[model samples]
Target: MKGLLYLSLIILIATILPLVGCNGSSEEVFKGYQLPPEREEGTTVELVIHETYTDEEHQVFQTIVDMFNEDNPDITVKVERIPKGAQWSRLTQALATKETPDIARVEMEYIATLADRGTILPMELFWAEDHKETLVEGAILSNTYNKRVWGIPDQIYTSALFYNVRLLEESGSDIPDSNWSWEDLMQLARKVSDRNPDVIGLSYGSSLWELSPYMGSYGATIYNSENKRIEIDSPEVVKALNLLYGYQLDVEGWTGSPIQSFINKDAAMVILDSNSIPKIEDSGIRFGVTKLPHGPAGSVSNIDGTSMVIFKDTEHPREAYEFLKFLTSSKIQALWADELGQLPVNKDSFKNVDVNKHPYLEIFMEQVSNVIPKPALPNYSQMEELFNMEMQKVFKGEKRLEHVLMDITSELNGETQKD
Candidate 1:
């Protein structure tokens, strides 16, 4: 498989895409077509961006693109929005066929895979040294692969412990504080459930990288850097998994999609990111956000968000890069956060945005350091699939904790990748 991946990108482009009627349209006709250069006033770059965001979210981004066009008359950025889950698959196919957009907004987890395949342009191609200090370190580290940054973070991403304060109060439980523990959280969960049996006690996330938040609390890591091993079979991990399993067995809690379940009030408390705050707000439930409860190891969480990367075959690399840089500016970042309920990659912007204006965001900003970048593992894609499959078995009470851990660890240890 590794050997097959080494064909020169140029060869792939020449043989795969016929350059005749390849006018960027008709993916079926010009199946691998890209827009030709515009020798006009400004460089016109096509950007493909997708998210689970509402049309309102896309409108905010269009506003940003318009702002960029107004200031830099020499650059034109055309934006296209696609749905999230299918975005990465489509982008990969496009790259393989040499028909790719000039710019793509990618999830940070996919950046390494795309970069390793030489599909995305390197950040050093555009990012200035002075700009380095202006952004958060995690954003840089998240985009780095093979010692070169492959993308620039458009949004600083992190999650908080979101709870329905009114529900907790009604259940006669005190609201959680910054220093709360996992035990405290569980107790609160049980209380809310007992008080309102119709509503669930918790909504645990079963999404990609969802398990990371609980692992560290018990002094466990899915992948332990110190020993250079995947620790799925470790006692700490089993304890963590069982804790969640216990919740499901006890109260009929846990959902495949925590964010939606939370919005529906199917669960009283759940782990959520600031990006989902708008929906929670619109749900008309009195709620608040806090740092996740700590375990013996301390409070730790995962940062899962998207970044913007330029495709290597872009005709307008400079223009696309300029637009990416423009998005990083403090004022523009603040606007992005204001429109989209996310944290700013620029640290200074955090101070400028009044929390009163964007509630629950401050908790996200405060916990940024506690939240680590998804492991820079090249094979994380494969591991995520395996983890989810194994977890489902445990959730259904079909497998014992020790037996499942052993299987997961054995599978992960046998998988190998080249650096």
Candidate 2:
């Protein structure tokens, strides 16, 4: 009986050992090497933005985010708006410290520098992979850098000539049409100027961004592309400056106050972007918008507004790309444009919407159709600073127009050479 029991135990051990060592030709070892399944939803993406507008505008942005989240339950977005006047510097610091958010709102002028520094991701890869075609041509070109697309334009604002319709009618001067020349505008301004001692003829913003288009339309390039030189000293630029300065000084009651002065009804006409339309409408003043006064070369206007860009350091690049794509969609763009009083970049949004329905908006949209984007170079901000300082000197009557421009051109050329 003992021998039989021992034999059974040995058989049991042999059976288990063979199963554990199963490298035999009849069976295969179970080596665990497959990846775990992906999560049902994507991670939350963080966005850094600026509180540049009113609380209502911020609420609209929140509404858009809420709608996006409702449609995509698996993904979420968190927006953090930096304090006013500090967004650009703060964002730059974040990039330097490698602490950038997943996405950010950027001005068109700043996009080139951020892209050149590799702080923002190129959207070209996502655009190609998704095969999306909602973006307009002007927007695509504006957000691109060195042949690589960097962002999606969420909004666009272009400058137009806003005049008091009543003032124009009373002055016996007709508002210039799209084909009107600079000389025609000057004459109208002079006529309008003689109307009231308290009303200035025209006003433009103090920033160089607002002044560059007029210079460009005179067939003058601020910076020479090939030689990397500043060319504001050219005869055309001096002539353009002289014209602008003449309006501020020679025209009766012409005060050199900024564009806001015109909105306060202190000036007969003002050069402004679409952003100011809502304010102008709320002021209870009747106004008419027309294409910018033409210069020697032709009519040209500068484009302004914010764009949505994905940071290169974002944890969820694909998700960020998707959100940007949705933001620029025609439907969403039209809704935002209509509500916010911004001109929609989509040409289709204008259909069925009478330009006269919203008197100022109609004019703004019309002006947008003819705009030319400014030079989107990496050094644009630096160039703008120099240009503004020199222009201020000229405006203050402290320096000759030719001397101020030539000095600035030389200084800018020197800076570019060091680059």
Candidate 3:
């Protein structure tokens, strides 16, 4: 009887030990890694990014990715590059096929479209509780649609007048100022233009979006917000187009490119987005940046930027959100903006010593505060296409300003009706 009791106790101890070990192992697996706060474990996320950036920019992005991976080993992020111009169409097709990346770098103009299509997940809860003050007001609104915040805005671009300071001084022309009017701008262009049979006074890339600020200065709206009708035929829009066409005709050396123009410095003054600043700085030209010249009504400028968004199909929404939050943090943004010459979306990032020391950085930041976000409409893609086509006709001098305006209004109205 004593031997049987001893044997039974031994068997009970063995069974209990194995069960305890199993419980510990299961807990370890569940507690693998801690992502931000709300993420789950054992999920891998994929990110899609633009292939347009320079090698240096890519290196910066990779460094950020490495930091994220170090902190969250259980959640892996794989990045894929897509061509810049093809990014939107490719993302659209992927979402349709249920292959969307967990996170995507999207254009600010497309935020509304993505939300409308249910491709993006709103991030208001994440941003409002942690990063509300970190971002600039204009940038935050750029990613907001119908009161829903669908993305985190990371970088920004604002239109500025880029002038060859040396050329302007050589031609005995005065530099433009914030108070300069449309007529003042025209005179300055005429003065700086190389009318010697080979030079033009001013050159613009010839897009309606690029020219919209000029139209806005005259109090023109592309769409009647209250009436919900296309208003490209407004008299103000016609006047803006005529002024743009005038530069091509009256300025002796003004020209357009079927291919590339601004990089080659084909014109004296170029109104370009802020992204082109670094390229122009590297060109070894002594350039100066000024506020975009004002028009008859008031001073106006357009905003351009990229937003960081998480797709609705992401397998690791929590992990992806953490990574995005890191990317948009003020500290990281300051480092990236100062080193890369890309404007930071965070207001405090502008206060960094290095960024403030850059000659053009302060001006760009000031402009960021005043610039207007593009129309956040689901039909913007269609509107952009029609606007570009009509503007091309005006640029080629094949259609009068009034005629192009009327045609664009008619076509846009038809599109809106269909929607």
Candidate 4:
């Protein structure tokens, strides 16, 4: 009986020893080797993002990713840089493949198209009421279409009046106040140019995007999205076009890249967006930025921005939303706006930013609150090109203002009806 008991005890000991070692000995082995600390135990998720950003923006964006990864050890965010003009094409192709990125940075204008194609998930799926309240209403509205929110706005911007201080002083004109009208702007322009014929009073582009604020101030609209028609030939639009063309024809100035002209000191006053601030600062030009001059509709500007959208087919929708939320958080939004010279989409971000240091941001924020966004139509680009061509006819003296306006209105109306 003792011999049998000893054999049984030996067998039991042998069986239990390997099990104990399997449970704890490996940990001990790693501890003895001073292995790096174990990673947080979770299913690691890899999220691929497709984005198009300038070199400077790319650097800042990478830092944002790194910060996020530090906080979320289980999630690895990978960004693929798409060329500036190739985002849409690459995105469409990716959608056809199994390797579609989890997130894509799309322009405000492309949001509607992506939503229409059902390529992106509706924001309602992930956004809560509390989250909705944190964003700027105008920014949220720009991302909404068909009564559904489609994208999370990341960056917003609008144009503001930029004036050269020395030029204004030499022209004997007082700095324009917020309540100044088109007439006031005209007077300022005239005074500045009259003082020096070599320097143009104002410099601005004639593209539809550039002209949006001008048209809005005069109570003109290129497309009536609610009514689904073109209103470019309205009396207000014609008046606005005539007045602007007259400025260029009667006033002394050039009509190309506004920022370039301003940097070259070829113009005393220029209509430019916030992005132009750094270039102007680099040029060492003493400048002041203010709201655009008022018109029949009061001070007006057009809002636009880049947004992030999640693919409908993304395997990790929850993780992707976390990132979008992260991007739009007050802290991140404020940091992005401060570094990129962009307007923040999160209203709460203002608390962290010092507008005194970035005075132009204040003007931009004010403009964004009450500005008209570009119509969120899939074919907006097509209409923009057509309007550009027709408007050029008036500015180039190739066609009468009234005639060009009539033709553009008819053409755009036809396109609207086709939709």
Judging by lDDT against the true structure, name the best candidate: 4
Model 1 ranges off by over 4 Å: 1-54, 81-86, 193-199, 218-231, 234-236, 245-252, 257-266, 315-319, 376-379, 415-419
Task: Name the 10 consecutive residues with the lowest summed lDDT in model 1.
Answer: 19-28
**Residue 82: error of model 1 in Å?**
4.2
The digit string of per-residue lDDT tens for model 1 on 1-419 reads 12112144323323322211111221221223344554576335445443344588688888888998889766667777778878978887887899888887777777766765557677775678777778878678777655567788886567778888767777888888778988788888888888889877777865546777787668776655445466777898778777877777888676788888778877778887766787888889888888988887788777767788887777777777778888888898888777666788887788777677787788888877665556544556666665676676667777676776675565455532343
Q: Show model 4 residue runs off by greater than 4 Å.
A: 1-44, 252-254, 415-419
lDDT of 3 at 2: 15
Worst 10 residues of 4 by lDDT: 17-26
> All candidates' lDDT scores?
0.71, 0.65, 0.66, 0.75
What are the TM-scores, per candidate, against the unseen true structure? 0.77, 0.78, 0.77, 0.83
Off by over 4 Å in 2: 1-53, 128-140, 195-198, 223-229, 246-249, 252-254, 352-357, 415-419
As for candidate 4, its clashing pairs are none
Which lDDT value does model 2 have at 312?
62
Residue 323, candidate 1: Cα error in Å is 2.3
Query: How do these models rank on lDDT, best leading?
Result: 4, 1, 3, 2
Candidate 4, overall lDDT?
0.75
lDDT of 3 at 269: 73
lDDT of 4 by residue, 272-345 (tens): 87777788889999989889999989988877878898877777877888888888888998988888777888
